[model samples]
Structure formats: C-alpha cells, structure tokens
Target: MKINVVKGTRDLGPKETARFQEIIDKLDSISYFYCFTEVTLPIIEHAQLYKRSVGETSDIVRKEMYAFEDKGKRLLVLRPEFTASIVRTFVNNKIHALIDLPFKVHYHGPIFRYERPQAGRYRQFYQYGVESIGVNSPLIDAEVITYGYAALSFIGIENVILKINTLGDDDSRNKYREIISEYFQKHIHKMCHDCNERLQTNPLRILDCKIPSDQEIIKKAPKIHDYLSLASRERFNEVTKLLDQSDIPFEIDQTLVRGLDYYSEIVFEYHYYSDEGKTLGALGAGGHYSHLVKELGGPDLPGVGLSFGVDRLVEVLKEIEEDDNEEDYNSFVLFYLIPVGDVKIEDVYDVLMELRKQGGYSYDMYHEKKPLKTLIQKAKKRDARFLIFIGEDELKNNTLTIKNMKTEEQMVVNRQDAKQVIRSLFFSSMREG
Candidate 1:
C-alpha cells in the first residue's frame, strides 16, 4: 500500500514555504503599520455559524463547506472563510465591550472548501485578511480598501485594478433584490439551473454567474445604482470621494455583487492580469456588512473587511518574479565559514560562538571534511556574501581570512577585529544597494 496527499491538497516544500512566509511577513508588517492587531481563530466551528453569517443561499454554505457531524452528533464544519468566524469570536469574547469602537484585527490562516481545484485555487488554501468591527463609516470603508491596495503594492503585485460596487443599505438592497428578482424571473427559464436556484434565493448572485449564455441576460438585468436610496447613494459617493482624494484609481463595477450574503454596501475586488493578458480574476475582495454582528447574537455593530487568496497570490507572484528575475533574499548567507585543511570542529568552536554572539548577522559553517572546492561551491549555492576560511595557519596567527564573494576581494584581519571589518563591509554593501 502507498500513501499520498488527499485530493485538492498538496505539500509546500522548502522554496514554496519560504515564499509563503515572506508574503506573510510583508503582510504582517503592513498590518502592524496600519495598527491592526493579529488574532488566531479556530479552523472548526459550529455549522450554523457560517449558515447564519454567510447565508445558506451562498455557494459556500450550499456546496463548498466541509461540513460533518462530530462524535457528539453535533454538526461541525471547517471554516470556509474568516469573516463569520471572526465575528463569532468578537461576539463570544465580548471584545467590542472590552476594546474601543472599531476594534481592528488582522489574520492569516488555512481555510477549507470542497470545490474542484483550479489554476491558483485549492480546496485547502490560505487566506490573509483584516476586519474592522464596531463602526461603519465611508472613511473607514475607503481606509480598508486603501489598506488592501497598499498591502498588495508592498508585496510587489503590480497592475491591480480596483473594481468596486455598492450593494446599498438594507432597504435599498431589498428593493433592488425585489426588482431584479422580477427581471430574472421572466428569463429564469432560459438561464442555468444554478441561476434559477439563485433567483429563488438571492437574485444578486445571478450576476455572479460565469456561464457565457447567462451573461447576456445578466448584463441586460437592472443595475443596482438605478434603485439606490438617497442615503446609500450619498454613502457611496463619500467613499469614492475619499478614494479620489487619495488618488487611488478604481472602476465602478455595478455588476459585482460579490458572492457572500453578509455584504451590504461598497463591495470591491482587486483584479490582475497575467503577462499573456489572461485575466486571473480577483486576487482579493471584501465589502461592508451592516447586520452580521447583530445576526450572530451580538450588538448591532457594522463592520468592513477584506481577504486575499494567499495561494493564488503566491502563484501569481511566482510567475511575476520569474519574469522580473527577482533575487532570493531568504537564502542569502551573510557569512559562510568553511574549515579548510584538517580543521576540527572543536578547534574553531570559540570563533563560532563569537559569530553566534554577533546578533544581527546570519552565518553558517561547513563541518563536513570535504575538499575546499566543494565547500566553496556549497557557499556559492547559498549566496554567501562573505566567505570565512578557518584553518591551522589562521588559528595559529589568531586571524581570520575573509573573501568578498561579489567583489572577489580578500583580506586577513585579527580575529578580535573581524566583527568590525565585517560590519563595515555589510554597511558598505547596504550603501551601494
């Protein structure tokens, strides 16, 4: 018998894992700059959590959720997305009562869904997102959008177009839903079976359908902007106005209702195109929700959030990096020590301890009794900036021989002053860079 990874999931080896970490680190830094505290949520929750927050009409609850009954015969589910769970955490912990209004939080973790894997998509994929709970303002909405845009920019993902739409307030959304329902009902017979099902539940989801045949009818359907209430329209104008003041480019996509039911106003997606001009769709998306916290048995607190498909972002970034010939900074070795000629580990243990004490540097040593040529080759593969040779002559002289791999320069320095010399060299390289 043989064992293999389950379908729709795969392992991330060294390189991929490093890339994932690098991305997470960048996101974490940006989130911190924006004053977002990090929080970890459980992967499992009651099945009703998603159903109540995400809505049973959405595809995630209806089809994609990894739902099962626990040993207690109580229904449980792997979280399909983060917002619902985050809201549950907020309510259950009473964070809103403890913290100030608009409690901001950021999170990154694995999300489970049972959909067929596609390009840049997985049934078990990671998500990076932020939630601003307890407040609902146009400025906060714009700020969340700007934060996501800034995060992607900091991650080196270029040419992202912000596609935005307004779902309006509850009353406006209800009115539009009723109007769109009538329009889709007239053509429901000609639409896909899923679209027919959506018509009975959420008519806005019909706009999210990808079937080519259904698109023509969907395009002909009523636009939400036409029915937006005065307040909803003003709120949207304020958001767009703030974005304009920030000089962030965007497009008003009236057709983009997003896939979730919790979204009520100002939904947006960050879209990107490949080098070949093929659309990769949304790298990330989010929107404002008015009733989720209240619906989850908490106070009537509105919130806004955004989430990036980290798996898709990683794949897209790999392609872009390959084209740009980006450097692998993760594998860079600041100092690589190679013991030349019959050098025992015990002989140079003190020097190794000194290097370890030099807190800000990354160094490694070759302990195997291999040829000097082989050792140098290994150092080159690790992209060592400086090569340190430890042998009998240097040990006797109480000196260290250092070679700059980039400049091909060599120098011998007193072991006591080696740290100073290396620090100078490192700073020089930084200045040059």
Candidate 2:
C-alpha cells in the first residue's frame, strides 16, 4: 500500500530548500542590523491564552484553531498568531526589566490553521515577524512598519502598497460598533453565518467579510475615520508623519480592520501588486496589537508587530521566476571516483574520503559508477564545479587529475598537496559579501 504525505503541505527539495533559506537569512540579517533581537516561543500554547486575548468571537480563536487535550487533560492549541504568545513570554519571564524599554524582537516559525487550502493559503504555513513591546508611542508603530518594509525590500519584494487603518481607542470605537450592530440587525438574515455572529459580538469584523453582498453593503456604511475621537485621529496623524519623514509610501484605508481583536491605533497590511497590475494577495503584513497585554495578565504595556506568510511569499517568488539566476547560489565542487572492476573498491572509498576530510570539496557517484565518460555525465547532472578521476592509472603515479567543470581546465596535482590546495580554494568560493 502506498501512503502519501498529507495535502496542503509540501516537502522542499534541495533547490526549493535553498530558496526558502535565502529568504529567511536575508530577513534575519537585515532585522538584526536594526537592533531587533530574535525570540522563540513553543508551537503549542495554552488554549486559554488565545481564547482570552484574541477574543472568543474572532475567527482565529472561535474556529480554525487546532486544539486538543494533552495527557493531563490540559487544553492546548497550535499557535495561530504570535502577539499573545510573545506577550505571555514577556510577562512570565519579566523581560521588560531585564531589557530596556521598547523590547524589540523578531520570530520565525510555523503557524497552524485548520482552514481550507488554496493556491497560496495552507493548513501549515510559516511566518517571519517582529514585535515591539512596552511602548505605546505612535513612533513605535511607525518603526515596526519601517522594519517590515525593509525586510520585504531585502527579499526583493518592493512593489507592494501599504494599506493602513486605525481601530481608534476604546472611546472612539464604542459608537461605531453601536451604529454597525444596529444596521446589521436589519440585514442579519442576508449575511453569511460568520458575519451574522460577528455582527452581534464584533461589528468591526463585518467590514472584513468576504461575501460580495457584505462587501458592497459595508462600503456605504459608516467609516471608522468618521467616528475616531480627536486624540485617536491625532495619533494616526503622528504615525503617518513619521512614515512620511522616513520616505515609505502609504495610503489610508479605513476598511483595513484586521481579523484579530487586540489591534488598535494603527493597523496595516502589505498588498503586493504584480507587474501586470493586480494585487497578488498579501506578500507580508503586520500591525499594532496594543491592547492584548493587560488581557493576558501582563502590565498594560502596548505593543506593535507584523508577520508575513512564508508560504505565500515563497509562492510570489516562484510566480515571478526570480530564483533562476544561477549566480545567486553557492557552488560546491565534487569528484567522481569510478572503480575499475579489477581494482579493490575499498582503496578508492578510503582515498575519496581522505580528499573530503582534509579537503572541503563535495562529490558523489553512487549510481552508474562505471567508465570515465558516464561518471563525468553524472557530475554534470549534480552541477558539480570540479571533477576528479581515481582509477588504476592514478594509483600508480601518486597523482590525481582535477578538471574545472565550467572552464574544462585540467590540472595534475600531487596526492598530498591536493588536500591542502582544494581546502583553500573551496573556502574562498563560499565567502559572503
């Protein structure tokens, strides 16, 4: 019987693995330069942690979460989001006192969701994100946005429009919720089940409904800008002022209410527009989830953050055929040893390893290990940079013939010197900028 891997997930082969690693490594390097330290949290977090902070009515907590009971009957969930876990870690460990204010951190890991798989959406996806804790200033929100922009730029994803909005403070949102709840009351029967439930508990969510009818209806409805209090409006202005001074382009979008609950003041999403002039879904996005602190039993410290779907970002890279540049990847040299039938294969194996041990060149010819011509073809298939021949003739001369695969140049070097010579050459080839 053949058992296949689960759907909505994929295995990254060698080339694909390199592509994904390059994206993360570039982001990590750039974020570190900005003084954002790296932090990690467990994949499984307490179920109540999300339920209490992300709001019971939010889609992330109400449905699509992978929740189960462990041996002790303790409820746990595969983390669907990051802000809650990061906050929980900050409070439990007392990170604020140990670190200075504006505790900035970046995280990269897999996040779980039970939603249907799509072209770019998956049940198991990866995210690379940064969070700033213990700061309520609008400048913190602006700085997080700048970090996110720099990260995407570092990864060659620059053609994205930054759509930003504000949830306003508690005092500003109450009246807007009242207006939306009353309007939805009359049209409750017209919305999808999720929107109907969202109407009663979180009228703001109605703006995010995917249904065409709901989208059309909400367009004419009250805008969040019209209801924002004077102080909240000034804070939004301050965030944009910083963005303007930093030279990052942005557009005001009142309908950008995120799916999470604890977001307030400033929220944003990065929408990538293809060269063909269409929004190619979200490449990477994040926002200020400030109010989730006190809800998670921590101080009323505010925070701002952003996370990009690694799976979706990878898809965009593939769609544009950007990874085709052969020069961008590192080249590893390889040697193929063809064991003549009469020669003891053990000696060939021992010598080949000696070349690899003291020398750093990589090589393999596990299959079709026959004549020189066949072995050379195999080396080309593996993209080997250099090829070596070990046969009856080389054993007698105490010498080895190495050929540069690209230039087809051949050199005969002493057996002992080959190790030291190749070690220096290989290390120089792998040097970074």
lDDT of 2: 0.80
**RMSD (CA, angstroms), candidate 1:** 2.8
For model 1, the stretches where C-alpha displacement exceeds 4 angstroms are 68-74, 274-276, 322-331, 346-350
* lDDT tens per residue, model 1, 264-341: 989999998877886667999999999999999999999999999998888788788774534444466788888878
Against the true structure, candidate 2 reaches a TM-score of: 0.92
TM-score of 1: 0.90
lDDT at residue 145 of model 1 (Cα atoms): 98
Question: Candidate 1 — what's its lDDT?
Answer: 0.90
Count residue pairs with overlapping backbones in model 2: 1
Model 2, 62-160: lDDT tens digits are 778999999999999998988788889988988877877888888989889888888788888889888889978998999989888888888888787
**Top candidate, metric TM-score:** 2
All-Cα superposition RMSD per candidate? 2.8, 3.1
Whole-model lDDT per candidate: 0.90, 0.80
